[model samples]
Target: MTEPVLCPADPAPVTLIGPPLAPGPLVFLGDHAGALIPRSLGTLGVGEADRRRHIALDIGIGQLGRLLAEHFGATFVSQTYSRLVVDCNRAPFSPGAMPEVSDGTAIPGNTDLAETVRADRVAAIHEPYHQAIADLLAGRRAAGLPTILVALHSFTPVYAGKARPWQAGVIHGGPGSDYGRRVLAGLQGVQDLTVGDNLPYAFDDTDYTIPRHAFPNALQWLEIEIRQDLLGTPDQVAEVARWLAPVLRDAMEG
Candidate 1:
């Protein structure tokens, strides 16, 4: 018998906040929101401190996503498993989907994996998380509702001994990314904020979420990356949501 990646006691792979068919064009995604590891995974051979680090999850995204969802009255779908187990934003079985090393820290559990093990991670966590998003989008499309997919993420202020200068970043690509450009411009207009235009990362073939759900559907999409340090407290998260919500609302309406 094949062992399951998620036991019965494990948390559900996807956490959806707000109505699936909420009255709006915005849909928020927290692809790396949680830091939960399956009981079966045994911490993936990572120490406690490392498990709480950015490698395990995108810090503060869960709270921020929920706040944004409530503010916009849009659906917020988030992954509940650690990205160290299976990065839901990457294609299944891709190197990044189950990284062996992240930011120079080795992932012992991911170093040598049988194909079946990798498949189980995808089947249990990655598939369900994305399927929920897909199903919600399909339903919205069937209902003739316009959709704007916004992926929320957080990055460490420092990576591999180097400090990042940007307060946030907006990643967009392809011919259908006009909304993303508008968001970038809006963020740039914010006073005392340094926003990167795809500096920390870019939208490319390695990305699976937007390309998988947004591209073929031709939905306007934007992937926002905030510096993790800025989200260290509840007040900080709320402040971000406050400023960001208006920018997104204006971008969508403009």
Candidate 2:
């Protein structure tokens, strides 16, 4: 879907879908929970079939976000639009920020766009989400809560037909911290767990979430990745949540 339409019926669509439970050192965010292919955009060459791929959104981040929030008594923030419109994880400069192709699916709607159209995606989706995150972090800072930022995400097992073995990956931006170290240690006993420090992708300023917000302040944070197959369903989400809950508790307390 390359030909982008600047007007989406609803511009800013952020979904906070959980209780504002206890005040702990944890905050769960699903930067790509959105999967809405706005009605105005039409088909954009590829049909609804193509947009349903993992490239459009994190396969099961919404469920993961919810479980993490409830299990850890944390606040949750999620998006309600598809990443085919604009990727929340990517910095605005990254070409994939508004990708024309992801995995093997080509997004026809993202192809040709003038500055105004491009800016429209940013204004409608990116800015509002980032602003909300900023407000959350700011509030937590003022309230004296030890914030441990966790950006939940899921990755495809085979991209272009190659198998990926990492069941989970934790993206640690800074050198080291109690949060990152404890996370790695907690996950060590788990069988077949492939943990990547900067594996799939490293953190950079272009990453508006981790760098712009988490790293600059040296906040204890990690961008977590779970294999899509492992979390593509509700049962899967709950299982993964159980696997991660106690580890997160230790990180929050340690």
Off by over 4 Å in 2: 1-12, 19-21, 175-178, 204-206
**RMSD of model 1 against the true structure:** 0.9
RMSD of each: 0.9, 3.1
**For residues 162-227, could you state the per-residue lDDT of candidate 2 as single tens digits?**
787778877664643558667867776677677666656566656667777776666888777888
Report, for all candidates in order, the number of backbone clashes. 0, 10
Q: What is the C-alpha lDDT of each candidate?
A: 0.93, 0.75
lDDT by residue (1-254, candidate 1, tens digit) is: 86678899999999999989987999999999999999988988999999999999999999999999999889999999999999998889889999999987899999888898999899899999989999999999999999999999999998878999999999998956889999999999999999999968888898889988998899999999999999999999999998899899999877
TM-score (all chains, Cα) for each model: 0.98, 0.89
Question: In model 1, which regions exceed 4 Å deviation?
Answer: none
Candidate 2: lDDT of 108? 79
Candidate 2 yields a Cα-based lDDT of: 0.75
